[model samples]
Target: MKAAILDQAGKPLVIGEVDIAAPGPHEVLIRTAACGLCHSDLHFIDGAYPHAMPAIPGHEAAGVVISVGSEVRTVLPGDHVVTCLSAFCGHCEFCVTGRMALCLGGDTRRQKFGGARLTRGADKEVVNQMLNLSAFAEKMLVHEHACVSIDKDMPMDRAALLGCAVTTGAGAIFNACKLVPGETVAIIGCGGVGLAAINAARIAGAGQVIAVDPVPEKRELAKVLGATHVVDAMADDAAKQIIAISSGGVHHAIEAVGRQASADLAVAVLRRGGTATILGMMPLDCKVGLGAMDLLGGKKLQGAIMGMNHFPVDLPRLVDFYLRGLLDLDTLIAERITLDQINEGFDKMRAGTSARSVIIFDT
Candidate 1:
């Protein structure tokens, strides 16, 4: 199978043939259909996040099951599925407690002492899989727990976003924030995730949905996605504008951009007893917090992983939402490119112009 291999940090991924092993026990092999290029993958590409070299980096994806291991029962060959990075071990404490997304997923992969799942076809050198899925390749071998069967009617390109951006954004609102009808929301970014949050907030009956971004086009797109209002983050008083629009402060503020300033703004525009959910993956050394007065005012700040998702359940429902026309996925896709155009897709993301660029595999 051909895959984009990252040999070094801050370098382009090399497209070459890779050897993918057959499914192990509890694993599933998928014929990759579509994979979304996400900012999280860019973090590893730019060396912001440390990862093993010669790894295939991509997680947000949807595909058709080619085969499954002897023990796999969640899906069968010919089933359509969306892959998630938050693979969970069913017996773990987190899974038992209904926090499957937090499961360490140690049992989902072969033990370090075991043989590699992927290797270079040329030299037989092992190639690390990114986020347990590595959907950038022509095929992916992942734990059955990492994928959820979805409707076959759903487009693979759109379903790919549900794996990450949609789940993370809508999950933040539905799970982390537990947003109720008539509550006000302020989203600190208008990328794929932020726009999804905006759409979810509207569907949840939020009284007001404020979208914030420096990009005019994104702000406009956010409005189309259901944001009742849009604020320019580059303005002199972006936070103040949010507070003013909400008549004091928003009930929930979501930080979708992994930046210190955006996270801080999410905290800044929260109402008393309001919650600020930081959905972005900030730097390890970065610290975002509220001042003493804000805490005294009962403002709460929290971080969400994969939108606190339970992919097995949430992903299927999200697919339904799209199928019902409740979720606007049509506008979310900015471009559809081949595997060879993967780097250009990331370039569009870095430029902050495209909502999402999906790689459509010819299977």
Candidate 2:
């Protein structure tokens, strides 16, 4: 199978043939159909995040099951599924407590003593899997827990976004924020995730949905999707604009840009007792907090990893929303390219001009 390999940090990914092993117990093999290039992947590729070398770095994906291990029962060979990085161990305390996304998923990967799931060339060099599911490859071998079968009617390209960008964004609005109907929301970023959050805010019946971004086009698109108002993130009074748009301050402020400025703005635009959910993966050393006055006002700040998702339940529901026309995924996709064009797709991502670039695999 051919995969885009991250041979080294701060370098272009090499497209080459790689060998994928069969499913192990509790594992599932999938014929990759589509995978969305997420900014999070760029964190590793640019060395902002550290990982083992020669790894395949994609997590947002959807595909059809090729086969499953003897113990696997969640999906069958013909089932369509979306893969998630938040693989959960059923017996973990986090899972039992309904916090599956925080499970660490240590049990999902094979032990170091075990053989690698992927290898390259005649020399058979081990290729590390970036996340539990390395969907950049032609095929994927992942823990069954890392994937959930979804409606077949959902287009693979759109479904791929549900795996990460949508899941994280929508999840932040639905799960982390627990946004009540008629509440106000301000999404700090208009990328795929932020747009999804904007859409979700509308679906949840938020009284005012504000989208913020430096890009004019993205802000316009956000309004088309669901945002009742859009704020220029680069403006000197962006927070003031958001606060004024919401009539005082937003009940919920979501930070999806993964930048210190955005994080600060999220807190700045929140209502007295509103919560700020930071979904973006920021720099390791970056710190976000509320000022003493803001803290005294009861403003809360928290991080929602992968939107605190329970993929098995959330992905299917998200698919239903799309199928029912309640979710607008078509607008989220900016381009569809073949595997060979992966590099160009990343280039576009770096430019921060597009919504999302999806890789459509020919199976």
lDDT against the true structure, each candidate: 0.93, 0.93
TM-score of each: 0.99, 0.99
Query: For model 2, how does the per-residue alpha-carbon lDDT over 179-254 read when each residue is reduced to its tens digit?
Result: 9999999999899999999999999999999999999999999998999988899999898889888888989999
The regions of model 2 sitting more than 4 angstroms off are none
Model 2 RMSD vs true structure: 0.8
Cα misplacement distance, residue 269 of candidate 2 (Å): 0.9
True lDDT of residue 112, candidate 1: 64
The pairs that clash in candidate 1 are: none
lDDT (tens digit, per residue) of candidate 1 on 1-363: 999999998998889999998888899999999999999999999999999998999999999999999999899999999999999999989999999889999999876665789999667899999999998999999999999899999999999999999999999999999999999999999999999999999999999999999999999999999999999999989988999999999999999999999998999899999999999989979999889999899999998999999899999899899999999988989989999999888888889976999999997
Alpha-carbon error at 363 in model 2, in Å? 1.8
Where does candidate 1 stray beyond 4 Å?
none
Clash count (model 2, backbone only): 0
Model 1 poorest ten-residue lDDT run: 108-117
* Candidate 1, residue 81: how far the Cα is off, in Å: 0.5
